[model samples]
Target chain A: MFRAYSALIRKEFIQVSRDRNMLRLIFLMPVVQLLVLGYAVNLDVKKISLDVYDFNRSQTSRELVDAMKAGDYFIPGEEGQTKERRPLWHLADRFQDGSAQMAVIIPEDFSERLTRGENVTIGLMADGTDANSARIGLGYTAQIVDRYAWKHTGLSPPIGIRSAFLYNPETESVYYMVPGIVATLLTMVTIMLTSMAIVREREMGTLEQLMVTPISGFVLLMGKITTFAILGLLEMVIALAVGVLWFGIPFVGSPLLLLALAVLFLISTLGMGMFFSTITSSQQQAMFLAFFSTIFAMLTSGFFTPISNMPQWMQYITYLNPMRYFMTIMRGILMKGAGIADLAPDIIALAVYGSVIFSLSVIRFKKRTE
Target chain B: MNDKIVVQVENLTKRFGTFTAVNNVSLSVRQGEIFGFLGANGAGKTTVIRMLCGLLLPSSGMGKVAGYDILTQPERIKRAIGYMSQKFSLYPDMTGRENLYFYGAAYGLGRKLIGERVMALSERLSLREFLDRPSKGLPIGWRQRLALAVSTLHHPKILFLDEPTGGVDPAFRRTFWSTLYDLAEEGATIFVTTHYMDEAEYCRRISIMHQGQIIELGTPHELVKKHRAANLEDMFVDLIRKRESDNA
Candidate 1:
C-alpha cells in the first residue's frame, strides 16, 4: 500500500513540475497577496479630512481648531481656503460631496462661556456610512477636544480612562491580518490544488483506469491528500516567512506547535477538496465548488470580524467551520505567544473537525469508485 | 492449452433504476484465449466489462475472476486483471515512460522490475522515441499502444480491453491485435469488446450482445455457418434482425 501511494505521489509531482508556470505562480501568489492585502486591510483611521466652521472666531475656537489638526488623525479640508465661513448646515453638503468625513462647529458664545466658567458644548457631525472608521474618528476627535479643554482650564476631567492595548499594543492591522492571510492562503491553495488534481484525473478518464488497479480507495485517498498536504505546508511556510520577514509580524510561539496545528488544518482542507472531487464529475464543477466554499469558509472564519459580533445562529454555524478554530490558533500562537496549554480547546476542535471531515471524505471517495 | 477457466459468470445482472443494462449474462473464458465481445453502441458491453473488472457491482447473480468472487473480493480480482477502457486512460501530462513506471508501481512491482519492464515494453511497442514526450503530444495510435503497454506492465493473469482499437487505422489495428495474440500465447486470457467485425474474426470465440442480452455466442466460423451469412458482419446483422423480427 505504501509503495503504491508513493508511486501516485511521484506521479503527481512530475505532472505538477511539468507545468512550470503553475509551479512559479503557486509559490509567488502567497507572498504577493500577503504584502498587498496586509496594507489594504488597515483599520487605523488616519488623515481624515475635517471641515471646521467657527462662528465665534474667538481665540479659544482658533486654539481648538489648531489642536484638532495637531495630530495625524485629522487634517483641514477645503474649509481652510474660504475667507467667508460657511454655515453649519452646509457641512452636511460637504460630507455628501465626499469633501470631509467629519465636521466641527463652534457656537457664537463658545469663548464667553469658557471665560465665565460656564458649561459650553461644541457641535460635531460625522458621516456614519462606514461605521468602523466613523466611530474611531469620533473617538479621536472627542479626545482631542477634551485635551484642549484641560490645557486651557488647568483642570483634569473627573474620569480618567487610560486604556492600554494588549497583545498588539500598537494596533497594527498587519499583526492581526497576516496570520489570517496565511490561513486563507493555505486553504485556497490546498483545496484548489487537490480538487483540480483529482478532477483532472477523472476528466481525463485516468481515474477509471486507476479504479481497476489493486490500489484500494483508502490508499488512493491517502496518496492524494499526503501529496497536497505537503504542498500546503510548504505554502504556509512561504506565507509565514513573508509575514515575519516582510510584514514584521511577530512569531513568538513554538514553530513546531504551529506546524502541527497547520497539519491538522490542512487535513480538513484537503478532505474538503477530496469530497468536492467525489461529487463533481468535471474540473469546471470542481473549481466552482471549491471556490464558493472557500469564500464562504473565509467569511465565517472570524478572519475579518469577531465571531461574537455575529448572530447566535451564525456563531453556531462557525463551530463547524475548521477555519475559525485555525484562525484562533494562529492568532494565539503568533500574536500572544500562546502555548499548547493555552490553546487546548481550539486544538481539540481542530482535531475533531479534521478527523471527522477526513474520514467522511475518504468514505465518500471509496463509495464514488463503485 | 491450459484448461483452467480464468473468468466465470452466471446469471449476472445490473440495473440502473428501472433499466437493466446487463441482464442474466453468463459466460466462461478459458486461459490463453482471445474471447471477443461484439455489440453496438449502448449494447452493455462496457457495463459487463466494468462488472467483471470489479469496477462495478453486479445487481444480482454470481461471477468470479481469477478464482475470486467478484461480489465478495473485488480487490483481489482487481489484483489479478488488467483493464484498458475504450478511452485512452493514461495521464496526458506525464510522459509515456512515467506512466509505465507509475502503473507498474501501482501494481506493487519493485523498482528494478519496473525499470526492466519499462525498457522491454517500450522496445516491444516501439515507444522508445516517444517515451520522453508527454502522452498528449503523441499520435492517437501511439497513445493507444502506450496505454496497452502500461496496462500490461504488471502482467496480470487476465486482461480486459473495451474497444481498444475504436478509431485506429486498419494497419495499426492489426498490429494491436498481434500484440494481444502474443499475450494470449503467453497464457493470459484476453477479454475484449469491439464494434469491428474483422477484429471479431481474430477471437477464438465471439459473443454478440444486444439490449442487455447475449443473443449469440460461438466461434466466428461456426456463427457464420449457422446463420448462413456471407461473413461475420452479415451474421451480426442477421442476428440483430432476427431479434428485432422476433420482438415484432
Candidate 2:
C-alpha cells in the first residue's frame, strides 16, 4: 500500500518535473511577483503631490508656500499661471494617471485677511484610489495645513483624536503582505498541481486503469499527499529564502513550525482538489473550477483586509477557509514571534479542516468503471 | 481447478431509482471458467460487472466473490479480483514498466516481485522498447495489451474486463482473447463484457442482457441453435426484435 501510493506521488512529481516551463514557474514567478509588488507597486506611500495657486504675492502667502514645501508631505507642482487657480487644480489629471496624489489650493486676498486677524481656508483635493495611500496623503497634509492655519488665525478646533492599527507597526505593508502572499501562493500551487495531476490521469485513462488494481482509496490518498507535501515544503523553502535573503524580510518565526503547519495545509488543499477532480468529468472543467475556487478563497481569506472589518456573516463564512488559519499562523510567527501556544487554535483548525476534507474526499471517491 | 467457487451472484438486483439495471440476476462463475456477459448499449452488463467487483453496491440480494461476500467483505472482494475497463486506460505520463509496478505494488507485492513482473510483463507484451516510453506515446494495440498484463499482475482468482477489445485490430483482438483463455487455464475465472460477437465465440458460456434482465443464457452454440440464427449478432437482433414485438 505504501509503495503503491508512493509510486503514484512519485509519478506525479516526475511528470511535473518533465515540463520545464512549469518548473520555472513554480520557483521563479513568486520572487518576480514579490519584487514587482514589493518595491515598485507598494502600499506604504511616501511623497505626496500638492499643487498651489498663490494669488496673494505677499510674504505671508510665500511663507505658507515655503512651509507647505518644508516637509516630505508635499512636493509643489508648477503654479500654472491662471485665474482662480481652479484651472491650476484642474491640471491634476496627471496625478489621476498616477503621477501625483494630493493637491493643496490657497485662496486669494490672503495677506489682507491675515493682517486683519481673520481666518482663511485652503482647499485640498486628493486621488483616493488606493485607500492606504489616500490615508497617508490626507493625514500628513491635514497636519501641515492645520499648523499653518492655527499660527496665523489663532483658531483651534478642539477635538481630541487617537488612531491605531492592531497587528503590524511601522505600518510596513510588506510585513502584513508577505504572510498573506505565503498562504495565497501555497494554495494556488498545491491545489493546481494535485488537481491537474489527477485530472490528467483521468484524461489519459490512468485512473480507470488504477481503479482496477487493488489500490484502495486510503493508500492512493496517502501516497499522493505525502509526495506533494514534500514538493510544497520545497516551495516554502524557496519562498522563505527569497523573503529573507533577497527581500531582507526576517525569519523571526520557527522554520520547523512553519513547515509542519504548511504540510497540514497542503493536505487539505490537495484533498479538496482531489475531490474536485473526481466530481468534474473533464480536465478543462476541473482546472477552471479549481482556479475559480482558489481565487475566491484567497480574496475572502483575510489576505487583504482584517476579518473584523468584514461583517459577522462573512467572518462566519471565513471559518471554513484553511488559508485564514494559515495566514494567521504565518503572520503571528514571522511578525509577532508567536509560538505554538499562540497558534494552537490555528493548528487545530487546520488539522480539523485537513481531516474532514480528506475523509470526505475518500468517501466521495467513486471507483465505478463507468 | 482451484476447488473454490471464485465468484457467485444470487438474485443480485441493482436499480438506478426506478430504472432497474440488473434485476434479480443470479449467476455463478467457477474457477477457471471464461464467462461472457453480452448486451446492447444500455443493458446492465457493465453494472452487474461493477457490482460483482464490489465497485457498486447491489440494491437487493446477496452475492459472493472470491469467498468474500459482496456486501460485507467488499474490500476483500476488491483485493481478490483484477478488473480492466473498456477504455484500455493507462497513465499516459508514466512509462509502461511504471504502470505495471504501480499496480503490482498496490496489491502489496514487494519490490522484488514488482521488479520481476515488470520485466516479465514487458517481455510478454513485446513492449521492451516501449517500457521506457510514456504509455500515451505508444499505439493503441500495445496499450490494450499492456492494460491486460497490468490487471493480471497480482493474478487474482477472477478477472473482470469490460469490453477490453472494443476497437483493437483483429490480430490484437485475437491475442487479447487468447490471453483470457490462457488465464482461465491457469485457474483464473475471466468475466468479460463485450459487444464484439466474434469475441463471444471464445467464451465457454455467455449471458445476454436486454433492458435490465439477462434474457438468454447458454453456451454460444446453444444460443445459436436456440435462436435458429447463423451467429451471435443476428441472434441478438432476433431476440431483441421478438422482445420488442411482444412488448408492443
DockQ of each candidate, alpha-carbon based = 0.58, 0.42
CAPRI category for model 1:
medium
Best by DockQ: 1
Off by over 4 Å in 1: A42-163, A367-370, B245-248
- lDDT per residue as tens, model 1, B1-248: 48899899999999998999999999999999899999889999999999998888889989999999999899888889999998879888888888988998899999899999989887778888999999998888999999999889998999999999988899899999999998999999999999999999999999999999999999999999998999999989888988889999
Worst-scoring 10-residue span by lDDT in model 1 chain A: A157-166
Q: Tens digits of per-residue lDDT for model 2 on B1-248?
A: 55567778888889887888889898887788889999888888888887887777888989889898988777788778888887656777678887777677778898798788777776766778877888888888888888888888887888999988877899989977877877888789999998888898899889989887889899999999998998888998889889889999
- How does residue B125 of candidate 1 score in lDDT? 80
lDDT of 2 by residue, A41-153 (tens): 44445556556667666788778778878986567665643453457536446553435555555667667876776655655555433335556765775676678777866
* Overall local distance difference test of candidate 2: 0.75
Error of 2 at B53 (Å): 0.8
| TM-score of model 1 (CA atoms) | 0.83
| Cα lDDT listed for each candidate | 0.84, 0.75
Candidate 2: residue A184 Cα off by (Å): 0.4
